[model samples]
Structure formats: structure tokens, C-alpha cells
Target: MINWFDIRDYGAVGDGTCIDSPAINRAIQAAAAAGGGAVCVPAGIWLCFSIRLASHVRLHLDAGAIIRAAVPGAMGAYDLPEPNPHNMYQDFGHSHWHNSLIWGEGLTDIAITGPGMIDGHGLTSKGPGAKWAKRKGYFPESMAGMSAAELAAEDPEEAAMQGQGNKAVALKNCTQVTLSDFTLAKGGHFAVLATGVDHLTISRLRIDTDRDGLDLDCVRHCVVSHCRINTPNDDAIVLKSSLALGQVRPTAHVRIHDCHVSGFDPGSMLDGTFRRTQDKAPDQDGMTGRIKLGTESNGGFHDIEITSCTFERSRGLALETVDGGMLTDIRVSDITMREITTAALFIYAGARMRAPEGTPPGGIRGVRIERVRATDVDPRFASIIAGQVGTPVRDVVLSDIDITYRGGLAALNVPVPEKPDAYPEPSMFGPLPAWGLFIRHAAGLRVQGATLSTTQADGRPALWLDDVEAVHFEQVDLNNAAATPPLVCRDVRGLTGEMVP
Candidate 1:
């Protein structure tokens, strides 16, 4: 039985000026009333406020149709979800969902699918009502600001009505969700924010957002595949175990494959114009794209597999567990990265315990990375895999890896800081001690059939081992200049092959 309800029938004026959220919600209510069905939005520019999603209802946008977010002045027309006081524990964006264009909570069997687009016309990555300003190239003009306390003081309804939309789609405590075949432009904060969601399938989506493309928080059994994401302001695809739900919930059993993540110019990926606004890229450094595991990790990631992906003009693949969680059993294979501004691989286990006090530091183990080919890697910072002092990352295996770094004469005296309690970032460790690979404070490390080369003359060694034990490098090829030694060892125990045991 096919139960279908069109938005136009329920008085939705798709001419782009009418407030269509009521009609859309009414159609959704009618569809839900009839059990389960599709609430279809036909071809038109439907300017809407918040569109609340219900279970067993699929919001499908047809071709040439656009669900545009209403501007700040009209924000009061949207529906606000219940306020969560615990949102203070996380960042400003992760704290609320009711301020989004489309949001759902405690729902099941819901979907948003089609070839059409959901344009966050009135969303921003920073400040108040930021969407009102245009992104000239990289940095948008600044807007009025609010402190954390002031932001919390405003009425939730007023904030959504007068401020910028924070997200395009937000879902929490949901199951059996499907999001596919849609284009999301200028998605604020996150294009899709799924927390505590299970059995989710996200595929074939094109997202050129200002912030994160998709954030999976405390989600399990999710597959994100075949997506093209150009997020110059933040990460492309990220998995997190935040303390948003006021509990410890780990993100596990997630597979990300066949996706192309880039730090290209905004609005280019969607318009078939792949422009490069190199000067206007966000962050102190020009690194905004790439897949990341954490900055907000209370519970850790497990059973995660990332394969068959491409990264360009972005940061490297990062795996971090800093907040008293366990990260284990991860695999990454068959990846290619070009113009990498950072390391090809970064694995850090720190003591940034964001959880309740008295929690111990976390650990990362049983990880394997193979068949990775990276080019134009930054010569100053090598691919780093390190744990805290006395607490080593365990059983990491790298095989068949090839990296070509950009070499320039380096003084090679940058001290890596052990900011165990500060934020965990690839650049936080400062300029690396090696030119290719740097391994420190780890155990049971294995490297086989790996090659490292440089484009120009580099003064640093190809490999540096510090405080590492049970290490074995077999058939490793270090193509450094004749004046530079292939391996440099300091306080390394149980090492073999290139290094004297």
C-alpha cells in the first residue's frame, strides 16, 4: 500500500516566500496518521523554518526542488525541541538540534532522500546570524557575537527565530535511518548530525558545507559510503563519542568507504565548479578536510574500518582517543592522499580526559594500516604514532605504505610537547623529529615493505624511534640523501633491522 501526501495539497506555497513548514508538518502528520508513507515535496523553492520529522515518514525532495532555510528574522516560526541542559558539556554547535532546519529525536524508520537539494540558506559556522553575510572566498564578514552565558540566556525560540541555523539535519536516539541522493549546500555546523543512532545508512550525498560534512556521535552499525564532501571549514567525515547524552556511549561498528573528501572552495563541488580558494581557507593552517576520530571523545571508537577513500588538499587521517576511552581493532586500507598538509597517518593517545575526574588515560591498540600511498606530504612533520609516557599504544602494524614528502632544509630542533591534558591535534606535537616516520612511546610496532622518499634535500633522518619497544622493520626502504642516515635511534629498546639492536 502506497500512502503519499503532497505538500502543495496541504497549502504549501512553494513559490519560495511562503512559510511552508506548517504545510509540510501537516502533510507529515497526515502521512504518519495513515501509518507509514512518503511526504513528498514537489519541484519548487520551499523556504521553510524547522521541519520536524516523524517516524515511518520519509521526506522526499523531487528534482529541481529546494528546501531552503528561512533567514534569522523569520527564525521564530520554526519549532524548537526540548532544551537539554547537559549540552553545555560539549561545543556550542553540538549542544542543540531544535535550531536546525530539519531535526528528529527518538524516532525510527525515518529517511530524507531525493535528487533535490536542502540549502541551509541561513546558517553560519560562527557568530550570531552569520548566514546573513556572504562568504567572499574563505572568511565571511564578522557578525554580532554572544558569550556562552548570554547565548544560554536567550529564549530558545528567540535564538532560532533571530539567530542563524546551526545544522541542516539533526537526529538523536534514532534507528533505521536512511539519508541519500541529496545535495546539501552551506550546511552550518554539520550537514547531518546523528547521535546515538543505530542501523543508519548514509550514501550518495553531496555536501559542500561550511563546517563538518557529517558527524556520527555514539552511533553504531552505520555505513557512510559513496559521498562527495567539500568542507573547507572543518572535517569531512568524523566519528565521535561525545558526552552529549549525559552518559558514556561509544561509536562502534562503523564503515566509511568509497568517499571523496576535499578541502576545495565552497559551493564549487555542487555547481560543477571545483574552484580553489587557497588563500581564504579556514584554520590557522590550510587544513580543514579529512576524516577524524576525535576531539570530543568520552567513550572511544571500536571496530571501525575506513577503505577506498581519496583525500586531496586536506589533512591526513587521524585516530585519537584522549578521554579515558578504549580505541581498538581499527583497519584502514587502499587509500590515496595528495597535497597532504600534514602527516599521512596520525595516531595519538593522550590524557585529555574530558570525562569525569579520576578517569584514567585512554589507549589505542590492534590497529592496521596498509596499501596507503601519500604524495607531497609536509616534510617538517612526519607521520606520528605516539602514546603518553609509560602508556604506550600497542600492536600497530603498517605494511605496503609509500609516502613522498616535500623536503626543505630543516634545522631539526623543534621539541614535541607532551600536552597530555590539553587538546589533541596533529600539530599540537609541533615539528616532528623525523622527515618520514616518527614513532614514540609505543610497543609491539611492526613495519613491513614500507618506503619513504623526499622531493628535495632533507636534513632529518628518514625514521626516528624514541622509547619504542618490540619494534621490527622488515625490508623497509628509506630513500634519503647519502649524507642523512636512514634511521635515528634514542632510548629505543628491542629494535631490529635498520637500527642496531
Candidate 2:
């Protein structure tokens, strides 16, 4: 007793030219009226405006089908994300979901399963332009430069939707969701943005986008697997916790595995053809495609695991919790990285209080990264784990890791900034104190069966420590020919380490 509602029956002309959102939405309504069923989009280039999903409905796309997003204008064909006071801390594109081409809110048992393509051909990641920013006359004189509560008091209807053409698929407060086997091209700000969702599964996706491939925010109990993503302009897979939900909702219990991410040409990865159309250095070009947790950590993270992932021509692995959340019990293993422009691994805990005022800095603890192999890493920076002044990252373990880098001579007395409140980035610290690994303001660090080698002669030491405690290295080898001492320690307490020079 399956109820199947086809879009073509609802007068959807899939000829790539007409606006078919009304007909597709009609089909979805029909299916929803029949007590939850499948709404099918057949094989064609179906142009649409916005497709909102209902509960217990699955939107399935046939092969060779493409849902193209329509362009917005003064007539308001597209909606803007709902405005909030916390949005000023984050970008406008990261604030809302209802304005997207496909979106769901407060839904249950919904899925967008596909073997087709979703092309955001006419979406803009940049927020409101100068003209739209000037269109705030409806916002009330008393509401000007006021708090979120104050602004909401003046305008209870929330008639402000500033930015347009942002995300491709955005979901909020959803559960038991699944997104699978879809190809996305030129996905605007983010290809997929999921927030406050539980029991979610995203797999077998081929995405070649202009911006971030997938952004999981405030999600719980999720699994992302078997995806090939190439974004020459932004991160491939990113996890974030922003204050968009009006409170702290940590992203936890997540597992991501068996994914291939690269900074290759946009369409090359999905076509099974490797092409290097990007001419800029992978790191220098601002095309960041890596698996990262937190540049937005107001809510914090917990119990996350990423394994068996491969990265090529992209940035390295990163873990950061800078806002007022506690990051704990994270493990990453079996990672193979090549041509990394940044450090092989970067873990940072800073004091960027992007949350409400008086929110304390976050913490990082119980992190384990093992069985990693990185080759052709840029030597300007080293693998780094740095905590803030008052709080140090605790109980970190690195085992069976091999990194071959392009290390050269480190200049004398390179000053690294302890930017506790600044933005957290690997390159933001400038040239690292060590050529291989730099440990700062950390405790209980253990490195076992590790090897750090250089492709060229380097005058810097292989390891350096500052404000660190209880560091023990076992069977660690520093394969450097020109360095005088393999290890350098300053203000470090309880260091029992000897490198196999």
C-alpha cells in the first residue's frame, strides 16, 4: 500500500526553463495528504524556487534529474533567512534555513533520497547588499541597535528577511532524517546545512560546490559516510556549533568515515577524472577543503569519531573549541593526507567568546589521533596543540603517526602569538617554534611510535614545547640531518622525552 505522487502529474514540466516549484510542492502536498508517501521527481532538468518538506515524506529523485534553484529579484521569488540577534556574530548565510531552495523545520521522519543532482545555479552566499541593508525601515525606530528581545518586541511578525540565495538544503529541529546519493553543483553558501537535528544519516553523495560541501551544526546522533566532495573554494565537511538556536545545543555522538575530500577542479572528482584546474597553492588560494570541527563553537562538541578518511590537495585535520563549550572524548584514526598546505594536525582551545557576553572560554580534553600518514606537508608550520593561558588541553595521545614535511631552517626567535581571543587558525600563529611539532599550554601529552622527517635540510629542532607538562615520548624518531638538537623545551614541566636522533 504505497502512495506514490509523481511531479509530472501535478503539471510539472521538467524542461529546465519553467518554474516547477509550485507543481512539485503540489505533488508533495498530495503525498502528505495521503498519510505520508514518496514524492518523485523524474529525470529532467527541473527548475524550482523553493521546495519545503513536510513530515513523514520522502523526496526521491531519479537519475539524470537536476533540480535547479531559481534566481531571486525584487518580486521576491526567494525568501530570506529569519533574523536573530545572534546572527550578527555569524554570517547571514549561516543564520536561516527557510529561505533555501530546499528546507525543513521541526519535521520528523523526512528524507531526501536521490540518485540525481541538485544544482544551485542562482544562489548567492554573500549576505544582504547595501541596498537591502538599507531596506530596514520596517524594523521600527526603537528597535534600532537594540537587543534581540528588544527588536522582537517592536516587530513580532519578523518581517525582515535580508539575505537571498544562500543554502541549497537547510534543516532545523528535525529527526530521523536521511540524505543520500545526490550530486550537487555550485551549492551556494553551503551544500547541506543541518542544525539541531537528531538521528540523521547522510551518505553516498557526490558534491562539487563553490562553497562548503556540508555543514553540520548542533546535530546529534548522526552518521556521514561514503561521500566524494570537491570544493576548490571552501571546506568539504565542517562541524559547527553556533548560537543560532538561541541557546547552547552541542553537536555530539557523530561518526564520519570513508570519505574522499579534495581541492581538485569542481566537476572533476565526481566525473572520476582528476583535473588540477586550480592554479593557486592549495593553502594559499583560500580554497579550504578539510574535515574540521569548530570555527563556531559557542555550544561545544562531544563524543565524535572520524576514521578511514582520505584528503588530497587540501587543508589538514583540525579540532577547535573556542567558545563556551567543553570538547571531550574525540578520536580520529586511519587518516591519509597528501599535499597538505597547513599543519598535519591542529588542535586549539582559545577564548573567542562569540557567545553572549561573559561566556567563558571552552576546553579540549581526551583527544586521540593515531595511525595518520601525511606526506608533502608544508614546512612553514608544524603540527600544533595549543591551549589558552588559564586552561590547557588535557590528555592528548598521538600514536603510530608518520609525517614527511618540507622543512627548512627556522629563523632565530620566532615569536608566536598567544591570540586567545582572536580567530582560531593554524596559520594565524605565524611560523611555528618547531619544525615538526609544537606543544604549548598542554598537559598529559603522550607520543608513541611516531616518526617526523623532512624532505629537505632543516636547522630547527624537530620538537618544541612551551608551558607544557607531563610529556612522555616513547620510540619517537626525528629524521633530521641538519638540526643541532632534536628536542627543545622552555618552561615545560615534567618532560621525560628523548628523540631517536
Candidate 3:
């Protein structure tokens, strides 16, 4: 156990009202310059500017220690590091150069551990700017002194920028990192963003953010366990890969277990994919799903597992390959979800039809979902949407699952017209074959030991299969309080259900 105070003879300095960001940073730098060691922040309210971490350093905040972000503009100016090639689409905004509440880059074996809290002061930092941007229909014209338009107009590929948004912690190109036993709150963007790193572990952490709780991009072999991530914007925990089209570097072998995620609203979230239709330019937008893949899934994802997790009041689940990328060998088991408003699972392969599109059409094969239960799902649009327009979903199995729907399930076979004039738009856009399990344009799907129930008047069939092939259902139960047929099959063949058609 390396003691930070022993190595550098450092101690706590709290004036009670003012921040000690620079002092703590200087001490940490000095200690790191000598060799690797820990930098401890003793219990108290330490108002700080941004803190830049060094390699081989451990920033331990003692219990009850609250490290708050300094008032905006308190920290002096600093140069923005060069753009990380891995995070091109992630807009850092204007303040990409200055310090963060806690920031590090190219680090290894660093950690922030303790039973304490780190606040980003985002209410003060982001409220005015975000409000003004909303009114102006863009970011402000100027922030602090720099021209907001100039900053926004500057080419991300060429601009030398620093920090933007009051992030609590940002780790870039780091390895062997651990952040545990901390309460992170009120971040400007993401509470914790680990990019291009490996062997990372974030556990026993409570993250309540206005944005994403944990955003992992291009990372490998990571584990996020026993954490409570509550966010109003994007996914509570999101794992992503390359953004460039046709890039296939796969964020593989990741595991998320024993966590509670809540409050994911789909309407307000962005998936972080920017596509221009005429110019084929890329911009930033939030990707959908509480746990998602590809708006930027250029690199494929494989060997990922999510188990023993609980989701509350979520919009959706397991959004795989929205823009275009392959997702395989993924397992979701022993998961319980409640109060879901949207489809429980969405496997989309549509390409964002932009000029100079970069993504290739992708598919999901060898995916398994077992022992999953959901309740209070809006039946109107709650069902799995799998397979692409051309490349149908294949080799998927769902077993031992139970879903209680408050509304009804929507079919996944609505034809997406490339252009509005491609087909005569029909009236009475009827509810898409609302059912318990709806499968369309999929092949080789095996569903076993599942149950679905709903309480609605004029309830439709519990199971609806349309335009599908090679389906096998064994011991599946589709029960509703209302009197309705249990199964509906349209334009399908080779389908078998124990209860019959």
C-alpha cells in the first residue's frame, strides 16, 4: 500500500470556502514526478477547478469529502490536447483545453476510490449556457470571451481545442483504471467517459447525472458491476465502438452485471451519430437505448454478456446495430425490467441515409436472450424489431421469458420507404400487428418457454409472426385477460407452436 502523504509529505489544505484545485494538482504532479504514489483528499468540502491526473497515481477521496468544481473561469487558461483520433464525433465543445473537475489522459494504473462525492457544479456551469443555446437554436455566440460561433464552426479535425462542459471525470487512452465507492453527480455531459482503454473496472459507484452515467467507447475487456446509474438523457451505461464507416475494431469481451439502471427517456436522448444527407457530413446526435450499440458501431461487438441486472422505468433495451455493424455472441440472461414504455428489445440494421454514407449494412446472428422478465410495458409499440429490410435476423433464440404488457406489442414489418413516393402511403396506419411476440422477416428463430399477458379491450393475438421462416415455438404461453385468439401468423411457413395456430 503506497501512502500518498508519506511519499510527498503532502497534507490537506482547506480554506473551507475556496477551492484547492491548483494546490492538489501541484502536489500530485510533484509526487508523480518523483515516482508513482497516491494523492489523498481528506474529508471536507474541497472546492476545486479541474484536476489533471498523472500516471501511476491514485486519487482517493476520503469518506464525506466533497470535491466540487470551482466557479466557472476560476481556473486559468490552458491548451487543449490534440484530438484523440478515437473520439472524433464526440464534441468536447469550447472548453476542451482547460481543466476538468478530474481529467487525465494516456494514463495507467490510476484510480479514484473512496466513499465520497464529487460534484461538477453543473447547475451553475451549464444552466445559462444550455438555456441560451436552446433559445438561440445553437450554442451561444460567445462563452467567457471566445466566440461561440467560431468555436462551433472550427473544424474538429483542425481545431486545437481544450475542455468543454463541466465533466466530473474524463479518461482518455487509459488502461487498468478503477473508480469505486464514489457518488458522482450533476455532470455537464457524461459522469465518466472511458475511451480507447482496456481492463477497466467501475464498480460500487453511484452515478446520478443529467447525461450518460458511463460512456465507454472503443474499450476492451471492461467490467461494470454493482453500480446504480440513473440518468435522464442517454443510456445509463453505454458501450460503443468506432464512428467511421466500415471501421471494424470491435469493443469486445465486455461484461455488465448486478446493476440497477433507471430513468432513460428515448425522446430526449442522443446516440452520438452525425450524418448529413446532402453533404454526407457527420454531426453529433444521441443514440437510442438504455444499453445500445452502433450509431457508431463501426467496429463490431462480440462476446458481450449482461446478467443479473434490473431496469426500472426504461424506454428500451438491448438496441443493437442501429446505423450498421455486426453484433454476435451476445447474451442477456436473468434480467428483470419493469415500467418499460417502449420495445424491450430492438435490433435495427437500417443505415442512416446520408450522402457519402460510411456504414455497411449489418446483421445480428447468434444472439441469445433467456430467463428475462418484463412488466408494465406499453403494449402499443412494445416488441422486438429484428432483421433488416434485406438481411433478416437469423439464429436468434429467446427462452424462459415472461412479459406482462399494459398495452400491446407492435409488429416489426412496417415497410420503410426509401423515398416517400416509392409506395402509395396507406390510410388507417393501423397498429403494427400488436401481439405478445412479433417476428417479421427473420429466419431460424427459436422461442421456447415464454409467457405474455395483457389487460386491454379488443386485445389481439398474443403471438404474431409475419413474413418469417423456420420458426419453432415450444411451450410458449400467450395469455390475456381479454378474449382473443392466442396466435396470428401471416405469410409465414415452417412455424410450430404447442398451442396451435
TM-score for every candidate vs. truth? 0.91, 0.91, 0.79
Q: Residue 342 lDDT in model 3?
A: 56
Candidate 3, residue 75: how far the Cα is off, in Å? 5.2
Winner by lDDT: 2
lDDT of each: 0.82, 0.83, 0.62
Local error of candidate 3 at residue 391 (angstroms): 1.3
lDDT computed for candidate 2: 0.83
Candidate 2 Cα outliers beyond 4 Å, as residue runs: 74-76, 128-163, 279-286, 410-412
- Report the lDDT tens digits of candidate 1 across residue range 275-393: 87663344455656899998677788999999999998888899998878889999999999998877779998987666665778889999999999999987777999999899999
| Alpha-carbon RMSD, candidate 2 | 6.7
Model 3, position 247, has a per-residue lDDT of 39
- For every candidate in turn, the CA RMSD to the true structure comes to 5.5, 6.7, 8.8
Q: Number of clashes in every candidate structure?
A: 2, 0, 23
Better of 1 and 3 by TM-score: 1
Candidate 3 or 1, higher lDDT? 1
Which ten contiguous residues of candidate 1 have the minimum total lDDT? 135-144
